[model samples]
Structure formats: structure tokens, C-alpha cells
Target chain A: MRFPRWLLSDRTGLVLLAVLMIIGIGVPALNLLVPPDHPLHLTAYTVTLLGKYLCYALLAVSIDLVWGYMGILSLGHAAFFTLGGYCFGMYMMRQIGTRGVYGDPVLPDFMVFLNWKDLPWYWHSFDMFWFAALMVMVVPGLLAFIFGWFAFRSRVSGVYLSIITQALTYALMLAFFRNEMGFGGNNGLTDFKDILGYSIHADETRIVLFVLSALALAGGYLACRWLVSTRMGRVLVAIRDSEDRTRFLGYRVEQVKTLVFTFSAMLAGVAGALYVPQVGIINPGEFAPLNSIEAVIWVAVGGRGTLVGAVVGAVLVNYSKSWLTAALPEVWLFALGGLFVAVTLLLPYGLIGLLRRRRETAS
Target chain B: MSELIFEPEAAGMHTPVAPVDATHGILLYLEGVTVSFDGFKAIDNLSLYIGDGELRCIIGPNGAGKTTMMDIITGKTKPDAGRVFFGQTIDLLKLDEPAIARIGIGRKFQKPTVIEPLTVLENLELAMSGAKRLRGLMTTRMSGEERDRISAVLDQVGLNEQAQRLAGVLAHGQKQWLEIGMLLMQEPRLLLVDEPVAGMTPAEMERTAELLKSLAGNHSVVVVEHDMGFVRSIADQVTVLHQGRVLAEGRLDELQVDPLVIEVYLGGEDAHH
Candidate 1:
């Protein structure tokens, strides 16, 4: 009656998790130890890069839930992430109202400089961090739910789903690019003063944000892990593999897909909310379909079906991006495109997949 | 022979039937069922009745609507016109596939659709209970009772030795058994199986027939099969379909001699295949 646990155990899962914890805690701590004027500010750069990677990791995790589990490849998740960041950015902008060159408390400098009378209605709740955070999660989740409900119920799948999702983000990008949209126009939201009364310029605050990003990445990973390990997770994989079969197995496939899609989008929103303060800007460019593709590239590079692979993919891709841009800035786009093509054609399981395949073959 | 009578309600049996329907022993009634795909009639005015605890075999040519009939019954394809009743009460036509499944009707595809990425135990666990949310499903682990039920099913399917093996790694025959095991976990009143012995070896097919025959006294099974030998080994009643309609309905011996059944099987050219 007893079953051997080794056959059922996710072997790569443990090693992947251990590596994440080390990176999550180790990088930020290392940064804090490095003095301000040290010529080797390697740790500081690493912290910033890793924090950005965590944000990307969150985005990739969200994408994986829908793409790997529910069979939804939303090529527009970056739009939600950007929207969430913009919402947070508005709050940061308001906090910097009087500190700007024009010093208008009632209006942001861009608005005062443009001779606008008052702050818009959406901007009213920028003063409350809680409200901004609420917007950060809810806005994306609601959009995803509504969109998924309509799209999935109508029986959209495969390449058609990808195109529609891309069009959705494209529409948002176009809308946000316009100045009348009140989202600081094409320049977007920046020049943040402080979040929760701490100076943005302070290294302590930056490190805290870095730590928080790590926590988010870890929490996001665990949440995804728990989700995929559940009966629902089996249902998701079933839906991903054979949706019609899963539906016949007594599952509301569309509802299951919609729920997971919305949950994933909310995670992306949280990542973007964290990303804005640390990275310190939000723009229509973030909504670009290319950015969403980059997120997919990260997931594909790490391992699409594996959550830890997603985190690793994000960090590795971004780290390489920083290095490439610093070393050979002009050719970075070619390298990025080549990476995607290579991953798609060659490294299907990405780094994690290769490790898993190697282990399976060796055993 | 007198001491070994095969009565359904034998006193020594431990099987449980939900309720014995005295009125025709009808477990499923498909009345005027019609399904069309782009003006092609897949299933046209097909009406058939399956008795409780009966092992019914549906034999048809490739395009004779056997799969479509099963699809309509299992809620995979909605018929253009029909009344499908589960045990003369549940209106199957009004329900979706999942809803139909929850109401004690289970189906097995010809392809042996077991969740491959999951372990054999995990696949069965998913089939048994109906929680589809991660937070709740994760919070509650399978109880000892559930575990015993799973073990019992595994034993029945002859996969007890490979309980922890990944379903993806199982042989084609074992995968079919695992899928059958999955259906058993749900405790369904009726099982709709399509081509159970399609790709199976002779030994495997014989084992499958035995496994299905053992289910007949407690669970009603309607098998859509092309393998006549497999059908002959397990079927209590045989329903022959031709060109989107039932051509003959009777015991296997009687149907084998029917001219219409012969005509359809041999493509209306030769009266025998």
C-alpha cells in the first residue's frame, strides 16, 4: 500500500527553489554591505538588475499560468503591468507635486505648465497609497476577467487568442500615448518624491524595495507552485493539453481559464506596482507588444511549464540585456530577437528543461 | 449450472445499485437525437435505450455516427434535436459536458485521455473529487477513506504495482486501464467507452473485456467499438448503427445474422465482411 515518493517527487523543483532563495536574499544583503563610494559597486548594480529581474519574473510567472496551464498566451500582459505601474506612478507624481519646478500642489508640473485648472478625477486617490495599490491589482484583474470571459466563451484559442491579446495591448498603448488621456501623455509618470514618507534617493529605501521585490518573487513563485500542485492545477494542465477532454471530464474549462487568467494578470499588476517605485518611471512604451513578447521570451528561456524556470529566465535575460546594452548597445535588439528565436526553436524547456531532461536520461 | 446462476441481484454480491428501474430497466433514453455538421448528418434521428446494469455494444462503420452518438450522450456535442434522459429524470440535453459528468455520467475517449503529466495517483485523485480551485484543493489532502477507495480502484484496474508511475510513461494498455480507473473513481452510474481495445494487444484486450464484464452487475456500460471479438466477449446487448441511424437492435447472436447489419458492415456490396 505504500508508494515510493521518489518517482513522484519534482526533483528539479527543490534545486530551483534553493537557488531562488539564495538570489532573493543574497543579492540585496550584498548590496547593503557595499559602501556608497566603492569603485566596485558591483553589488549595487546587481541589486538593481536583480530587482528588475524579479519584476520581470513576476510578469513571466503570470504569463506561465495562462500560457502553460490554461492554454492562454496573452501577448498583452505588459499592458496590464504598465497600467498598474502608471497607477502607482500617479501617486508618486502627486507626492512630488509641490517639489516640482512649478511647485503647484493642486496640479502636477506638466498640468500647471500646460495651464490646466485641476487634477483629474482618476488622480484624486493618488495621495492614498492603499487606493493606488488597490487600483494596481483590481484594474488589471477586472480587465483580464472581462476580456477572458468574452474571448474564451466564444471558443478562441491558439494563434487567434494571441492576436486578440496583442490587439488589446496595442489599443491601450495607443490610448495611453495621447496627452488628453491625462496619464502625463507620452512622457508618462516619473519624478517621484517618496513612497510612505521615505526619500526615494536613500539607499536604505532602495534596498527595502529590493527586498520587497525579492519577497514578491518568492511569494509569487510559492503561490504559482501551490496553484499548479492542486486539483485545479491538474485541471489547468488538462485544459492546456486537451481542453475538450478536460471539459468532458466535468470541468467548466472557460471559467477555469478565466479565473487563472485574471489571477495571473493581478500578479502582473503587483509586479508593475513594485516595479514603478524602484525603476522610477511608467510609460506607454511599457504597454508595447514587444515588452510582452520579451516576458514570453523570459518564460520560454527559463522553462514555460515550470515556475522557477520563469524566475531564472527573467533574471538571466535581463542581466544579459544590461550587459549587452552596456557592451554592444546597438546590436542588443538583434541579440534579443535571436534569443527568442533560439529559445523557441532550440531550448524548448529552456535552462530548467535541459537540466530536467539531463537528469531523466542519466537516471 | 443451477447453483451458478448469473442473476444481477445475487445475495453474495457486494455491488450497490442506486435504484432498480422496473419500467423497462431503462438507464438512458435518446429520443429523436439529430446532429449535423455543415449539412452533413452525423447522427440523424437516432433513438436508442440502454437498460440499467447492461453492457451494450454499438457497432458501426467509420462514418456511421457511433462517436457522435457517444458525444451527444456525454455532452461533448449538442444535438440539433433530441431528448436525452439519464435514468428517465435528468435532462441531459439541458446540461453541458461537465454538468453531465457531475450528474454521474462518465466518458472515455478512444485516445485514452488520462492526464499524462500527473502521476497515476494524482490523475485518479482529480477524477474522484470535484474541487477546481487551488486554494481549497491544496488546503484539503485526500483522506484515508479516499486513499483506500483509490487503492481499491488501482487494484481493480491492475495498476496497483505502478501507482506512483507517471501516467505519461505507462504503456498504451495501462494508460487505457488508468483512464478506466479514473472513470471508476467518479462512481458514475453509466460509463461510455469508445474503442477500449483499439490499439491494445490481444492479451490486453482480453484483460479489458474481463475488467468491463466484471463491472456489468453494478454499473451500466455502453461501449462503442469496432472490434467484434472484443464486443462478443463483453456485450449483453448489441446495437448496430448505419448511416446516422440504428440498423438493428438485439442480442449479439441475433444481430450477427440480420441482413441490414451484414449489409452495413460489408458496405452494402457483400452481405458479409
Candidate 2:
């Protein structure tokens, strides 16, 4: 079992993987094995919160793939995230069959509430778990493909491309808020009960979800790490540095960008799917442009172009967010803004870059 | 035979074979190509033909449409009127920049444009012919022969020791050579080099002259240079461009003596030398 040089060479990635493995095993053991009264026992609430952070970390990695490597600063990645969430949420809605207040077997409570007698055409196959799982990736991947096809082909890049991406998530947020769109209106999808016949509220189920999120993050990181090691990865950096130079070298720059963009969107989709179950809800609020921008901030704060940095940034910032919002509430947004400004002015390469520079200088 | 059996090119090759039909002697044909920005004509009725394996030096004053000529040939700028063709069959106007490059034309910019963050070897690898598509680029590993080819290019460009170093740390002359090394990796039939000896030391300029001279006959090198002495050293034939069209086409010595070339280009001052 020979591991490739890329995996072994990445010191940060090795540390990240080791830390995840410990948490993956340790969290489940503490939650399931220990009695509630024991000091070592981890509550189910803590597990779910950790699970949510892992999902956010996965989303951050997806943003880093395109934004850092491919030089596509996508401020609309949450559109893909929310779309994946909605896909999974539809399945959960179907699972509620006759258990709702309306007690309708075929129609979801929202459809009945809206006076819709039948399930919409798009929502038909979502009742099956397999179909819903596949749609989670497909919907976001396809949207990214179509959008990137037009955008990259037209050579809309730099700040202009960033602006349109922000516009994309903002537009999705507005559209999903409408009840007419069939995605449960302003409140979005909620009241999820079972996932694959296991009670989502069960402690064991929450533990499984936590472990799965950890696994997904590890897998996504390895996949991205492997990608950047390939010759295509060099082409990505080349495109990022000088797109015209890459073009003159006979590489199809637009196609490369589109394919990578689509792949990144799929990764974001997977993160969102995991997120909905852990959080027990999916709403139009998930599509807010602010969510996408916050994801970018995580990558910038951690270090852009470094995969390990994305995960570390996401977890650290989100943990701080959890604490700050609880402790001071109103000052959380200001702190985030201040942190972003400070990082921009003081640490252009972010925290990881600063550490690497210090280590190099000391040695 | 056993060694040959393991060769990647032998087992379904990926390198693009040059499709340029230069048997008729002329490799590139630009006829009556005219492009304008605002009301002023940048390139007006410009007709130029580059011969097979010919080392042609193009000299002009500022805004003489020298860069614009290279632009039209490379598909960076579409001429508002006229025909641009590679060989006798392939219409260059129909293809885009990457498409033109794939067919066998390579262009170097006025400034050195290497991927600075990448190593010298990686920069050459990116410009190597073949595997431009998604599937090939994603999966194909560099073969042993490909590594040898890169090594040969590194030696040719005098950057073998710097192969592992980031291109960003390279000196100006070294960066220029690296850019040329990238062009050579494509194995292009026609190379459009823009201001190759600009901002180079005397020794570096001489070495560049030697390198460009070595590239001729194997590759049709069209060098657009401003330095007259460098041009005289390397150019067999000189094309003086003035106001978007050819002013004179002859040897450097003859062009130096010609009245029209002296009046429009040499300013009648440098012509005496």
C-alpha cells in the first residue's frame, strides 16, 4: 500500500487528516459509550454542532478549489449549497407521509397548505432516497455548468465575474422565497423526521451523521489534493496567473474553467446535503449572498490556494462565530468585518502563509 | 524491441503531429489584412508572406503596426478585411488563438510571460504539445521520453540548473529564454517572437542571437525587434514596416542603403553607418 508523494508531502494535510480521524472516533465514543452523568460524555447537541461545522468546512474547501486555484472568485456558491439542501429536504418531506398535522399521505403539508392537490412534476421522484441523493449533486453541477459555459466563454472574469456570482446567489434567494416556486416558500423545508428509516433525532443517528461529515471532508480534501498534484493543476495555476498566456499555449481555457467550476459546485452540493440533515432544516435563507461571502472569508483567513487552510479557517472562524454570537450577539457581524479588513491589510496571504513564512525565516 | 514496447508514444501516442503544409514554400500568408481602432487605420492593406524555415526580422517605429501584424496572424485580433491563411488550405481567420497554436503557430509576447509561481520545468510542461483536452490533461502522466525532451529544452535554453527553481526568481534574460523554451515545447512550425532582445545585456543579447539563430531552419522564426545591431547579426532578410505596410524587403545591408528605407525608417541619420 504505497501512498503517492502528494499525500505524504503535504504536512498540513496529514495533520488535518489525523485530527479529523481522532475527532471522528473520539466524538462517537464519548457520545455513545459514556453515560450522560459522566464528565467525559459528549452530548448529542455538541455532536450535531460539530457535524454542522464539518459541513461548512467541506463547503469552504469547495470554494477554495475554484477561488484559490482556478482564480474564479465565486460569491454565489451558497446557491449550489442551498440547492443541494432543497433536494435532500424534498426527500425528507416525502418521508413525512401522513405524519404531518394535515395527515396527507401523498401531499406534503406545504402543498396542502397552498391548496395544491398533487405533488409538482419536479418533486415526483424525490420520494426515493437514491434519486434525491443523485439530484443533490446533479442540480447544482448542472446549474454551474450552464452558468459557467456562458460566462467563461464570453471571457467575463476578475471582478466582473465575482459580481455576477454574487448576483446569481442573490437572485436564487429571491426566487426561492416565493411560494409559487414550490420549494416551501419563505420558511423553506423543515420538520424532517427520518433519514433512511433511522430516526434523525436519535443519538446514534446524530453520531453517524457526524462521522459521515468527517469522512466526506477527508475524502473531499484528498480528491482536491490529488487534483492539484496533477498536470491539470499546473494548468489551473497557469490560468490563474495569466489567462492569456495559458490561451496562447494552446490550452482550452474556458473548458478547463467550466469543468473545474462544475466539479467545485458538486462538492458544495454534497456539503449542503449533509448540512440539512444535521441542522434539521433547509431554508431560502441558506441562499443568502452573505453565506457565500462568509465562506470566501474563511478561505482568505485560513489561506487561499491551500486546501488544509480552508478546513482550518472554516472550523476556527465558525467556532469563534458560535462563541461571539452567543456572548455579544450584535457585535458578531462587526467582528467578522473587522477580521476580514485586518486580514486584507495585514496578512495578504492569510494566517497559514504567515506561519509558513515564520518557519522558513527561523530555519 | 522490448524497450520500444514500453514506450508511451508507441502505445497510442498523445503528442500532436504538426499539420502545417509548407511544401509550397510559403508557411504563412497574410493578404490585404486591415484592422482599425477608432477612425485611424492601425493596419491598412498589409500584405506579408513568411517563407518556410525563414528567419525574417521586422523593424518599425512606434505605432507602425508591428505588434498588430503578429496579433492578426495569431488570431488575437481579427482583421476587419482580408485573408489570413496557414499553409494553402487552412484559413487562419476561421480559427481562434488556441486553435491557431494547436495547428503549429506559437507567439511570444513583448514582455516575459512565464507562470512565475510554477517551477521552470512545470512551466515548460504546461506549454508542451498534446493533452490540451480535459481528459488527457487530468489523467496522463509525463512519460520518460517526455522528461528527456524537457531536459533537452532546459539545456537548449541554458536553464538546466534552474529547472527546479520558480520562474519568478529568474533574471530578465533567463525569463526571456524560459519563454522561448515554453514556445519550443509546443514544437511549433512558425514562431512569432516579439522584441526578443529588448532590455537584455550585451552578452545576453549575443546569446539570444545565437539561440534564435539555432532555432532557424528547424522552426520558421519571425523576430520583431527594435535593436538594429541585433537584427543585422541574426537577420538574413529584413522587412521594414512603416504605417501598417511593408516599406522595404531585402537584406539588412541593402535596406540600410535604400533611400526609401533610410528616409522612412533609418531617419537618414543612422543610414550612413
Candidate 3:
């Protein structure tokens, strides 16, 4: 098969794919094949954590597509993430049929607690796995399309666009926190029993989810890579550097922005779907503006405008987050802030940019 | 040079063409155009007509409504009262910026606004007239014919050797040429060039004058220039704008000699020359 020359030439992208391949195979082998006493035996917990990180990587890649290439700094990507989670979480909720404390086959535990008789109208088709899976992308994609249609048409951009995106996610968080919203209120969606007839607690299931997350990350990265390599990709960069220039070139700037923004939202939604399954829950807290901001930081630290950098930034920052939050919980927030400040002041191009500069100088 | 013909229908593509009826020899008609910002009239009762394939130079001092006139033509600024038409049929006032551009009106800003991160060739490709729709942009690959056209433009703009280089690394003069090259990729019938020779070496200015001159017979070039020497080199007719109205319209020499034009604009400047 003939690969695109641009994709083949991308050294960083190739290296990232190779690393993902190794981990995808090696992590599962270490967890499943190796004895529990072995030093390299990767525990189920570690696999789940890795799975979560992969989800975050996918989310970062999605953000990078719009923020890095298209110059849309979305501060509400977490809203799409949470929506995807909720879509799939609803499916997981349905899988609990009579297995819950309330023993209701149709209504989820939260709905039972809320004294609701029937499932909400929007929650109807989510009972089916395929439908729920579809909604994972569709829900976020639709919301982004509508929001972007208006925002981009009106020419809202820069800090104003970022501010409105933040508002969007915050508003979603507030709405989801309501019991009447049918999304489990503040607690969100949880108490899953099985997915596609497989027990959610099983080690094999966790391994599968982990592997799927890796595949999704790889797929998302490749899809985005392909997108940015196209003529449309050049148009995106054109829009980023100069909107008016692109407009005068006869490009419908609003349509381009809307389409890319919606696609990015769908990618974020997929990442969220994978995240919910691994973390064992999906909640309104996922829509917190801070979550969205943290995701942006991941892109910035890795390197804005570089697809591989997004994955690298997401994994590295999130790994540090896991370590710092566990080891020095109080300093985590301060550390994140300081790191962003430091990156801005010193490493304006982020880690990938630093690496590139070093390579150029050495050459 | 033989491939310069832009046939939208021949390629089985739908590139929007403004049904420009230039039979009466008027390509653009701006009549009674008036615009204001905060009740300050920037353009007051300004009426202008551009002939088909005419090289018209619009010269004026700061706030003389030169830029505002270009703005009105390109749909960037809506005139409070005017009939802006392309040819005798298509009303320019009804179209938006992109729509106007699609209909063969290309505007070059005062500053050279090239997509810096993109390569010189890629910048030109983005500015190519067709394949602008969402689906087309996503899937369209550069055909041999398109590549040939780009090469031709690269040669025309004198940036052939730097086709693969990022536009950001280009020199100031080269950036101006690249912007013109981008406009050329659109195959526009009318080109609104703003300050084509701003901040340029004398040599670059001469080359620009040649490029603008060469573009006239095929494309109607409206050059809004500050440098009088540059305008005199290329302009067939000069339109002097002052205080949102046309002060005079004639050759550069005639305008230079006209008392009203001299008192308002050329009186102080011609002393140095």
C-alpha cells in the first residue's frame, strides 16, 4: 500500500506510532501472560491507568487539530468529552437491567432515586450499544456544529471565542448537575455491570479496553495526520495565520471553522467514551472548565501545531499529574501553573519545538 | 503562458463567475458612495467608474478615503448610499467578501498578508480559485494542470526558486510578490492592489511596476499607490482622491500641473522631485 509521502516523512509521527504499537502489545502481554509475581507484571490497575492516559492522549490530539492547526483555542473540549462519556455511560447504565439496588430493568439507579417513572426522550436509543457508540461522537459533533455555525459566522475569534467555549462547557456542567436533566445529576453515570455481554470487572475486559484505547489513539492520530496533510489542512494553516487573507482568497472562513471544530469535537467525544469505560464512571465534573484548560496546557506543553507533540504532551503531563497528585497533592495545582508559566516564558514553542530547535542547531 | 485561460466549465467545476457585462466598457461602477464611522464621513458622495481592463491609480494623503473606496468595492465596508456594480449587471453591494472574490474581484491589502507558515507553493495553492468548498478541499489533490498553473504564477511573480520555502522566511519585497502571486492564482478579472510598492527598494519597485504593467491588458488593475514615481511609471490615468471625493482625474503629469491637485496633494511633494 502506498502511504502518503508527507505521512512517511513525518519522523515524530512515525516514532509515536511505533511507541504506541510496542505499548499496545507489550502492556497486555505483561499483564495477562506474565505471572503476578514477576517484576515486569503490569497490574490491571496500571493497565486501567494507562488506558485512561491513552484516552487523554486522544483528547489532546483532537484539541491540537483545532487549536494547533486551525487556530481555534477551544476551552470547552471537556464538554464534548463529557457528552461522549454520558452517551456511552447511558448504555452502560442500561446494561445494569435489574442488577441495580432498585432492581428496575428500564430505569437507572439515579432515575429510580429521583422518583422518575420513565427514561428521558433523549435517553431512548442509548440502550443499544451501537446507538450509544454512535451518540458518543454524534452528540458532541452536533453541539459543536451548531455552536460553531453561529460563532464562526459572527466572526467571534481569539480570546472572545475562547471565553465563549469556556462558557459553553460551564453551562453544560451546571445543566448536567440538575437531577431533572436525566444524566444522574452531580454524580453523573455509574454502576455498570457489563458491556456487550462481557463482565466489566474482568481482567480480560480491562486489557481489551486498554488495547482499544491504544487503537483509538492511533486511529485518531492517523485521521488527524491525514486531515492536516490535505489541501484543507493548508487552508486551515492559512486561516490560522491570516483569516482575512484566507477570506479574500474566496474561502468561506466560517464554514471551514465550523467543519473542523465539529470534527475536533467528535474526536474529543470518542476519547471521552473510552475514558468513561476505563475510569468506571462519567460525571458532570468532567465538564469543569479547568478540565478543558488542563487539556489545552497538555497541548501547549507538548507543542502546539504538532500532532505528535499533543500525544507526547498529554501523556507526559498526565503522567506527572498522576505522580504529583499522588505524591505531593497540595503542590500539583501550583506545579501545573508554574509549568505553564515556565513554558510560556522560556519554552514558547513547547517540548517538541525545543527538540526541533536543538536538532536544527546541531545539524 | 498558453494555460492562462481560466475555464471553470471546461474542468467540469462550478467556480462562481460574476456575469460581468463590460459591454459598455465600464467594469466597476461606484456611484454616490457614502460611508461614516461614528458620524464622521470617511467617504462622502464619492462616485467613480473603472473602465474594463484599465490601469487606474488612486492617490491621496492619509484619510483621503482611498482605502475606504477599495473597501466599498470589495464588500468589506458597506456604503450608506451607493450603487456599486460589477459590469452593468451584477450589483457588487449585494455580495459578501468571499462572494465578491469568487466573482472575480481580488483585493490585496496594504500589508503583504501571505500565509507565513505555509510554503510559497502551498500559499498559492490555498489561493487557487476553485476547490474551495468543504468537500472539494478535503479530497482534491493538485492535478498536473493545476501544478502547471502554479508554476506559471511562480515564474510570473519571480518566486519559482523559493516555491518550497516557507513564506515567513521571504524578504519584504518577495512577500509582496507572493501576495500578488496569490491573487493571480484566483484568475480575478479585476485586481484591487493597495500600496503595491510600499517599503521596497528602488529595484523592487521597478520590478513591481513591470509586473503590474504586464497584468493590465488581461486583468483590470486598480493600484492605490503612495509613491508618485511608482504611480507615474505604471498608471495610464490617475484619480486624485481628497476628503472622501475625487479631487481630479487625468494623467499623472496633468494632475501634477493642476492647481487644485497641487494645492491639496502634489504642491509640497513635487518640490522634492
lDDT of 2 at A217: 96
Order the candidates by TM-score, highest first — what do you get? 3, 2, 1
List of clashing residue pairs for candidate 1: A250-B98
Candidate 1 C-alpha lDDT tens digits along B1-273:
112212312211112223424266888999999999999999999999988889999888888898889888887789999898888567888877777776678889899888888889988887774443333344336778888999999999999999999999999999999999888887888999999998899999999999999988688999988877888898878988888998888888888777767767834543222
Q: What tens-digit string does per-residue lDDT give for candidate 3 at A1-363?
A: 997787888899999999999999999999999999999999999999999999999999999999999999999999999899989999999999999999998999988888998888987887799999999998899899889988998999999999999999999999999988888898888878889999888999999999999999999999999899889899899899899998888877877788789889999999999999889999889999999999999999999999898999999999999999999999999999999899888887799999999999999
Question: What is the alpha-carbon interface RMSD for each candidate?
Answer: 13.2, 7.5, 7.5
Top TM-score model: 3
Of 1 and 3, the candidate ranking higher by TM-score: 3
Candidate 2, residue A164: how far the Cα is off, in Å: 0.4
- What does candidate 3's lDDT look like per residue over B27-125, in tens digits? 999899999999999999999899999999998878899998988898889989989999989998998888889889999999999999889999999
Worst 10 residues of 3 chain B by lDDT: B1-10
The residue pairs that clash in candidate 3, if any, are none
Of the two candidates 2 and 3, the one with more favorable DockQ, higher being better, is 3
Q: Model 3: how far is B87 from its true place, Å? A: 0.9
Q: Which of the two candidates, 1 or 3, achieves a greater DockQ against the reference?
A: 3
Per-model clash counts, in order, read 1, 0, 0
Q: Measured against the native two-chain assembly using Cα atoms, what DockQ does each of the candidate structures obtain, in the order listed?
A: 0.27, 0.43, 0.47
CA lDDT of each prediction against the hidden true structure: 0.81, 0.90, 0.90
Per-model TM against the reference: 0.91, 0.96, 0.96
